[model samples]
Target: MKKDQNDRDSAIIIPFPGLKDRYYEKGISSLESHHFQEAVDFLKQAYQMDSTDPHISAAYLAALYENGNYDDSKRMAEELLKSGIGSFYDVLDIYLMILIQLNDYKQVVATLKPLFEENEIPPEKAEHFLQLLKLSEKAVRNQVMENSPKDDIPFLHQEQSPQDQLIGLGMLKDKNIHPYLDSLIEMLSVEKVHPFIKTAILSLFKENKIDQSILVEKLGKKETLNPMDIPSAEEFPFFHLVKNQMESQLRDHNPVLLEQILDMIERHSLCLYPFEWEPTNPSVWTAAYRAMGYELYGENWNLEKLAEFHSVQEAELGTIFTFIVKLEEISSAIVSPQ
Candidate 1:
C-alpha cells in the first residue's frame, strides 16, 4: 500500500514545472498595476528561481524601490553594478535616487563627479544630473552652516523686542521664511499674542498661500467671546445667528461663502478704522476684523447710523443686513428640530 501511494504521487505531474517566466509575468503585471509589495513578492520568487536573469533582477530592484525598501534596493543596485550586468546607468540612477532620499549628499556628489568628468552621462540625462548635483551642493552647504559654532550666529547676540521681532519677521524675504511657518502659526493662534505679530503672521500665510482656515476659525470663535470669556450670543441675537451660519458654511467647506465672510470682515475693518491700515503695523487688520460684528450688529445701530458710521450708502448696508437675514433663514431650515 505504501509502494502504491508513492507511485500515485510520482504519477501526479506538477503543471508549469520550473517555469520562472510565469512568476516574472505575474510580477511585472503587479508592478504595472502599482501593487509594489505584491510585485516584490512574486519578483523575489522569480529571482530565487533564476538569479542570473537581468530582467528579473531589474524588476525585483524596481519593486523593492517602489515598495520603499530602500536598503534592499540599494544593496541590489550595488550588486548589479559590481556584476556589470543589465543597464549600468539605469542601476546607477536608482542608486543615486536612494542616496538622495537617505540624504547622503556627499556620496551623491562623489559618485556623479567622476561620471561627469568621464562624459559617461547621456546628454538627455546630463541636465537632470546637473540639477541633482546643484541641489546636493546646496544641501551640503546648509548642513555645514547648521553645524557651525553657535556663537558665530549673528542673531544670538542681538536681543529683539516683541515689536522689533514682528517687524523683522514681516520684512524677511519670502524665499527664506518657510522654516518659521509653524512658529508663526502658533503665535497667530494664541489670543495673548501681540496684534502686530498676529498681523505679520497672517500676511506671511496669505503670501505663501498656506491654508488659513484653522486660524480663521479660531479668530472667529475668539471674536464671539465677551470680556468675561463667555459667548456674547445672549446679548446679540443677530450676531449669534450670523456666526452660526458662518460656522455651518465653514464645516461644509464652502470656499465661496468663507471668502465672502472674510471679505465682509476686511471691508468692515477698512471702513471702521481707515487710518489703522498701516503696512508697517499689520496688526490692525486682525483688530479691525475681530471688532466688526460687535461694532455693527452687536451695538444694535439703526440702518442709517450703521451706513453713516461705515461711510457707505444706506442701500449697501441694507443689502448686507438682508443677506445676513437670508443666511439665518437657510441655517434655521437645516438645523431646525423635526
Candidate 2:
C-alpha cells in the first residue's frame, strides 16, 4: 500500500462513539475521490465504533481488500457475505474480487459457480465469468510456463509486487494451501493458467526470500507434468525477475508512476513475428496487465503477446482492464509522490 504525506503525518486513530456515520461517509467519499488512506482511517473508525454495523463492516472489508490487507479482508469478507444483506450479486462480485486479490482463483471460480447457477446467469454475465476464468487459467499457465525451465525444479515461490505478494502469501498460508494451490495446478494442467498469474507467481518468488520451490515441486508432482519440459524451464527466469520488479515497485509509493511506465512500454512495445500485441489502443491492453499487478507485467508478455499476435491480431488487448488493481495504492502514492 502506498503511503500518503498526510497519512504519514497523521497521528494514530483515536476512536470515539457518535462519529461512526460521519467517518463512514468520509470514507466513502475518500474512496470515491481516491483518497484511500484517509478513507481507510475513517472507515476503520466507523467499524471500530459499531462493529455490528454491516454497512461499516462491508466498507471496511472492501477498503482492506483494495489496500492489500488480504487475510483480514478475506476473513471480514466471508463474515460479511455470510451474515449481511445487500445485492447478492454485489456481495458475490466483492467475494470473487477478494479471492482474486488473494490470488485464490480456485475459490473465485467456486464462489462464482452458485451465483451463476442460482441466478441462471445471463449469457453476458456468464461470458464475463468465463472471461475471468480464462484469464485465471491463463495466469496459472503463465506461471507454470515461466517456471518450467528451472533445472533444480524451482519451488512454487510466488513473486508478486509487495501488495500482491501479501495476498499471494495469504493464500499460500491459508489452512487450505495444499488443496487450494493443488486445485489451481490441476486446473492449470487441464485449463491452463493465465499468463498474468504466472507472472505474479514468478514475481512473488523474486521478491521474498521464502523457499517456495519445495512447495511448488510438491504441488507439481502431485498434479501433472507436461510431456515437454524445455519450454517450462525457459519460463522460470521470468518468475524471479518479475517478482524483483514488483518488490522494487512496492517501495515506490506511487502506482501511477508504474502505470505511466507501462504506458511507455505499450507505446514502444514491439510486435515481433507472431508474438505481438496489435490492439488499436495499447492502453487497454496495458490496463489489463496492470490489473494483474505490476509484478507480473512483463512475465508472459512477449510469449503471450506473440500468441495474441497470431490469434487475435487486431483484436488482442492487454489484461489490466480485466484484472490488476491497487488503484488506491497508486493514487495514494500519487498524492504523496514518494
Candidate 3:
C-alpha cells in the first residue's frame, strides 16, 4: 500500500555525491510500500554514506519513527536540527512527534515554545503546533499533580506491600519506568511470589507487547508448544465420541446442539462460559475460535454469529469448534480435583 502523501513529503531528500541515487530510490520505494524495516535498512546505508544529507537523514528518521524506534528517530532528528541542514520546521515537527511518543511532554513544551514565540512555524502548521503545545502543557500539569507530595501524617499512612508496589509500578505511565523494568521482571519471576502478582507482571508485559519467554522460563513452566503439536481428540476415546456427536449435530445445522456442546464444555470446566482461556496449550483451531469469539462478542458471546462474521464454512467451523470443545475437556480433566 502507498503511504499517505504527507508522509512521503515529510521524507526530505537532499542530494549528496557519496550516497548512490539507487539506495535513496530503493529506500523511498520501501517507505512507500509501508515496509518500514526494509526502508530503515536501506536508508541507514544511504545515511552512512552521507550523514550530512538532510534528505537521507529525514527519510531514515521517518523510517525509524514508522518502525517504533522513537529513541533513534529522536536522536536523528536532533542531529539534523543541530546541523542546520534540513528545513528547521520539518525537523522540529519530526522531533516534536518523537517527544510525544516518548511522553517527554515537558521537553515538547520547551522545544515548541521558542519556535512559537519566534514565529518560525509555517502558517499551515501553526494550528497543529498550538494543539500539540496545549496538550504538552496539560500533560506537564497532570504529571506534576501525579508526583505531588501527599499531606497525610506519617503515623497515619499505610505501607503498601511489595506485591502492591510492583503492581503500581507496572501501571505507571512515566517514561522513567524503563530503568526499573528489569528489576520488576526479576522480582516477578521468583517462584515464591504470589501467583496474582506474577499474573499482573505477565499482563503488564503482554499489554506492552514485551516478550515474556524469559519470565516464562524463570517460572519453571515447560516451554509453550505450538498449538498444532498438542494432543487432541484422536488420543482420547471419550473426547473422540463427543467430537463425533457434535459433528453430526453441526452437519445437520441443528442450533440446539450448540447448547449441548456448551454444557459438555462447562461440565468438564474446559472453558469458562463466554469462552476465555489462558494463552497456553491448545489446538490452533481452539485458539482461533476463542480469539475470534472474544474479539467479536467479548464477555457477551454468540458462537453462531462469530462463525458467520469470519465467513467460516459450516463444516470447517463445526470441526474447529468441536476440536476446541474436546481440547478443553482434556485440559480440564488433567487439572480437575482428584
lDDT for model 3 comes to: 0.56
- Across 43-119, the per-residue lDDT of candidate 2 in tens digits comes to 99888788777677777777776677778777877776677654444555567667766667767767766666687
Query: lDDT of each structure?
Result: 0.56, 0.48, 0.56
260-335: candidate 3 lDDT, tens digit per residue: 4434443342222112233222333343344333443445655566556544554565665665555555444433
- Of the two candidates 1 and 3, the one with more favorable TM-score, higher being better, is 1
Q: Count of backbone clashes for each model?
A: 0, 46, 2
Best by TM-score: 1
* Backbone-clash count (model 2): 46
What are the C-alpha RMSDs, in order, of all predicted structures? 18.8, 15.8, 17.2
What TM-score does candidate 3 reach? 0.40
- C-alpha RMSD in Å of predicted model 2 compared with the true structure: 15.8
Model 3: CA > 4 A from native? 1-19, 144-338
